[model samples]
Target: MPIIRVTSLSEPGLEVYGSLTERQLKSFYDDLGGLFIAESPKVIKVALDAGYEPVSVLCEEKHIEGDAKDIIRRSGDIPVYIGERDLLASLTGYTLTRGVLCAMRRKPTVSIADVCRDAHRVAVINGVVDNTNIGAIFRSAAALGIDAVVVTSNSCDPLNRRSVRVSMGTVFLVPWTWSDDYQQELNALGFKTVAMALTDKSVAIDDERLKAENKLAIIMGTEGDGLPQYAIDAADYVARIPMSYNVDSLNVAAASAVAFWELRNR
Candidate 1:
C-alpha cells in the first residue's frame, strides 16, 4: 500500500482531497485525467464495481479496524490512509460520513453521437444550472431508459461531487456528451426534437408524436424560465405534462421523470 500519514491538515499530500472546489473536482475527475472523491463506502464501492481505479482512501482511524478494513481488503493493492476523526474532518472540510472516501481516476467520456447513435430516446439540456437537478435528471434518465444525455457547455457540470453523490453515482453509468452547437447537431441527425413547454402549441406529454419516432430528443430547460424561444422554435415538436386544476408544472426533475416514463417505449 502507498499509504501516507498526515498528522496536520495542511499536509501537501492532502491537496488531492483538500484543495479543489466541487466544480474543480468534477473537471479534475473527468476522464480527461483527474480524480473524483467518492464519499460513503457504498458509493465508493459502486464506483469501483464500475471499473474506476482508486488512487487512495482516507478513513477515520477507528474505522480501520472495523468497516474500513473489510472495504480495503476488497480494494486489492490500493493504499488506505488512516487518520483520527478530527484530522480527517479537518482535511476534508466536513464530517466524514461512513468514515471512508475513495479517490478514483475518471473514465473516458463518450461522445454525443456515440451515446445517441444506439439510443432511441435521449434527453437534451439547455441551461439547467442546479447540480442537484442535473444529478436527479441523470438518475431518472438511467432509470427510465433514456438512451443518452447531451448538455450544452453552459449547463451545470454533471460530474459535480454533489451531483455524483445525489445520483448514487449513476453519472458514471450513463453516457453523456457536450454540445457547442446543440441544436444544429440535433437537426442534422434526423432527431425529432421535443421541447418541454407550456405554450398552447405544445402537445400533450402522451401525444403519439413522442412515441411515433424511434429517434427522439427531449429538450429540458432550467427552473425559473422554461425553454428559451430559440430552443422552443427549434423543436420538431413541443409538449407539456398534464397537471391538476391549480398546478402549472412539476419541478424540472419531477417533470423529467414523468416525461421519460411516458415517452420511453414499454
Candidate 2:
C-alpha cells in the first residue's frame, strides 16, 4: 500500500535489493532474523504462503499493474518501490525477470530432529555448494516423495536467491533443516543411512534391500569430490546408480532424482 516511486539507486530501503551483498542481506537484522530477497511473483507467493514476513518489494513500474499487481496486493502495506526497467536493472545489476523482487525475513532455523521427525525417507544434502544443483535436488526431492531434506553445515544455503528461484520455490514446500552431525542424528532416529557413492562394496541403488528399509536417509555429496570417506564409512549402505555407455555417475541433482524415485517407499 506504501507505493514509492524509486528515482535513484541510492534511495532508502532499496538496499536489500540493490546494495547489500548476500552475506550482508543474510545478517541484515541478525537479532530479529536475517532477510532474503525473493524474485518473481510465483516464488514470492510460495514464500509468503510458507509464512515468511515481507520486508519490502522492488519492481519495475509496468509490473506495478501487470505481473506484480497481485503480489503488491498480497503484500499488505509493505513498502513497494517502483521504477522504470532501466533504472531498476541498473540498481539490481541485472534485468528483473518477472519484473518483481521481494525481501522477506528468514524464518528461525529448524533442527534436524524436527525435520526428520516423521519422515520415512529423507535426503541429506552434503557439501554441494552449487546453488543450481541444490535447487534442482530440492525440486526433485519434493516431486519424488522424499519426506524431508537435511543439509549439512558446508552445503549451500537452500534459501540462496538463485537456489530459491531454481527450485521453483519447492524449497518452501519441503521441510528442511541444517545439521552439524547428520550421521549421528539420522542414526539416533533409526534411519538407515544410504550414501550415494561408488565404492567396491557399494550396492546397486535399485537393490531390493534398500527399498525394503522402513526408514532411510539418502546422502548426496559434493559435485566433484563426491562423499568423503568418513561419510561413506558412516553410512549403513553405500549405493550407486548403475551406469551404461561407460558413464560412471550422474550429476548430484540427476542422481538424487534417480535415487529418490528408485528407493521411494511403496
Residues 25-124, candidate 2, lDDT per residue (tens digit)?
A: 8889999779988889999999889898988989888888888888888879999999998999999998887899999999888888888889999999
Best lDDT goes to which candidate? 2
Highest TM-score, which number? 2
lDDT of 2: 0.92
**What are the Cα lDDT values of the candidates?**
0.81, 0.92
| Model 1 bad stretches (over 4 Å) | 26-32, 69-71, 74-78
lDDT measured at residue 153 in model 1 versus the true structure, 0 to 100: 80
Residue 235 C-alpha lDDT in model 1: 85
TM-score of each: 0.89, 0.98
**lDDT tens string, model 1, 238-257?**
99998889798888999999
